[model samples]
Target: MGSSARLRQFVHDNGPLILDGGLATELEAQGAKLQGDPLWSARLLHTNPQAIRDAHSRFLLSGADIIATVTYQASIPGFIRHLDVSAERARELLMSGVHLAKETVTRFDSGHQRPLVAGSVGPYGAFLRDGSEYTGAYAAEMSVEELKVWHRPQIDCLAAAGADLIAFETIPSIKEAEAVVELLREFPDTTAWLSFSCKDGKCISDGSLFTEAVQVARRSTQLLAVGVNCCPPDVVEPLLDSAASLQSPDMSWVVYPNSGEDWNPERGWKTSEKLSATIPELSHTWLKQGAALIGGCCRIGPALIAQLRRELKGDCTPAASAEPS
Candidate 1:
């Protein structure tokens, strides 16, 4: 079956599709250092591919129905700078992310529901590694066409590499979303989900209203779902409320918030004691609000994904937290 059909069928057979938790978070837990790397976990694609595969395997075993590849930061320009390789080799590295995830899923399939592989395409700001992703402050001179050009190869490479769907995730602006939707036309058969980073319940990180962002995103025929990611859990429900009034009934919604913490470009992530909502609790609430694809972003690991699976399936059995001893 095609990817859209498979997704609909899976949602009908099960509840909301369970996406894997943070790939890089679990990778760091596995002892692969990611500090100061432009490619982040994508660097592991060259240094230790098995680690990426193992992260996918853990999420699958944790009951994730969809596995997003580790290409979130694997842009061609970033690869060239980090790996010191040609553009051709950079694209190869991006394709390798899909291959590693696919290979893992192939080995883990035991005749149950097959998990969909989502090729991750992060924002242009991510390539900068300067925290502009959360702020959407690209160089003022960067034009929409330039954004399209910068993203075209990654999207084309992912589609050509045989991903089931494109995960245009953590998008901080409507311009980038439009660029991706336009680039996707070159590959008619490919479908994508465009999820954004928001500053509040109603506004994206760039200070654009979610209402406006969703309106722009819903114009794309290639988009299977549209919503928020890497935003605070406290803001998701209100963001969903803002989007509910704007989204079409046929359009699915995706929500994968970070652990309600702060990310400093120079110092990395820091926890906040004031944040009380746990991932599993917020996940149930997001589902009730119409999130068809649910998972976690940074700081969320396999154990929490397993918890979400149990919560969604109505399994009350308790499970261990992120760091099980």
Candidate 2:
């Protein structure tokens, strides 16, 4: 079956798809020094690929139905400029991210369900290596076509590498989301999901209403799901609530929020007081709100993902605090 059909079938058989938790977070826990690196976890695609594979394996063991590849900050230009490799080699590295995740899935024994690999395509602001990804300030300066041009190469490489789907995640603006949705036309066979970095219950990072942002998903028939990621867990319900009436019946809501902690560009993730509700608690609410795909983001590790799987399977017996232990 094609990717779109495969995803629909999975969601039909499964109540809600379980995505893996943070990749970079798990990698750091495994001893990969990613601080201040432009490549972030993508650098490991070349430096320590085994670390990336190990991370994927852990999420799989934790019961993730889908494991996204470590390409969220990877791009041809960024790799060439930072890793100092030729353009061809950079593309190879981008493809390697998908290969690593696929390798892990092929070796795992998940009983009746086969896990999928999503090639992560982060926003253009991520390429800036600044906090623009959260603020989306760069979207104001770049045209939709320019954003599409910047993202085309990475999407091409990921699709060619045989990723099950393209994860256009952490998009902070409507303009970039439009660019990505339109760019999907280039790869007629590829299916993807676009998730925004929300600033609140109602708006994306660029201050555009999420209801408006999700409209872009309607432009592409190939988009499997659309929702928010990397934002605090508290904001997800409101965001989804705000867009609930506007959503298409066929479009699924895919949400994987952070552990309710704030991010500091200079200082990294700032620890917040523990949330009253655990990820599974919040995810249960999200499931009621129509979220078809669920997981965690920053600071959410494999242990938490395992908790999420248990909670989703009706094993809710008061999981430990959602705070990453």
Q: How much is the lDDT of residue 185 in candidate 1?
A: 80
Looking at model 2, which ten-residue stretch has the lowest summed lDDT? 316-325
What is the C-alpha RMSD, rounded to one decimal, of candidate 1? 3.3
TM-score of each: 0.92, 0.95
Across residues 1-325, which tens digit of lDDT does each residue of candidate 2 receive? 8768777777878858889999999999989999899889999999999888889888887878899999999999988999899999999999999998888888777564678999999998887878888989998898999998999999999999999999999999999999999999999899889999988899999999999998888888898899999998889999999988977767899999988887877899887768524788888899998888999888899888888988887543222212121
The list of candidate 1 runs beyond 4 A from truth reads 1-6, 273-277, 315-325
After superposition, the stretches of candidate 2 with alpha carbons farther than 4 Å from their true spots are: 315-325
Lowest-scoring 10 consecutive residues by lDDT in candidate 1?
316-325
- The model with the greatest lDDT is 2
Q: Per-residue alpha-carbon lDDT of model 1 for 1-325, expressed as tens digits?
A: 7655655556666658888888999999999899788788899988999888888888887878889999998888888887899989988988998898888777775345677899999999998889999988883557879999999889888988999899999999878877787888878888889999999888998888998888888787667789988987889999998777776655788888888889999999897745424777877778877888888888878788888888887653222222111
Q: Model 2 misses residue 1 by how many Å? A: 6.2
- TM-score for candidate 1: 0.92
| lDDT of every model, 2 decimals | 0.83, 0.88
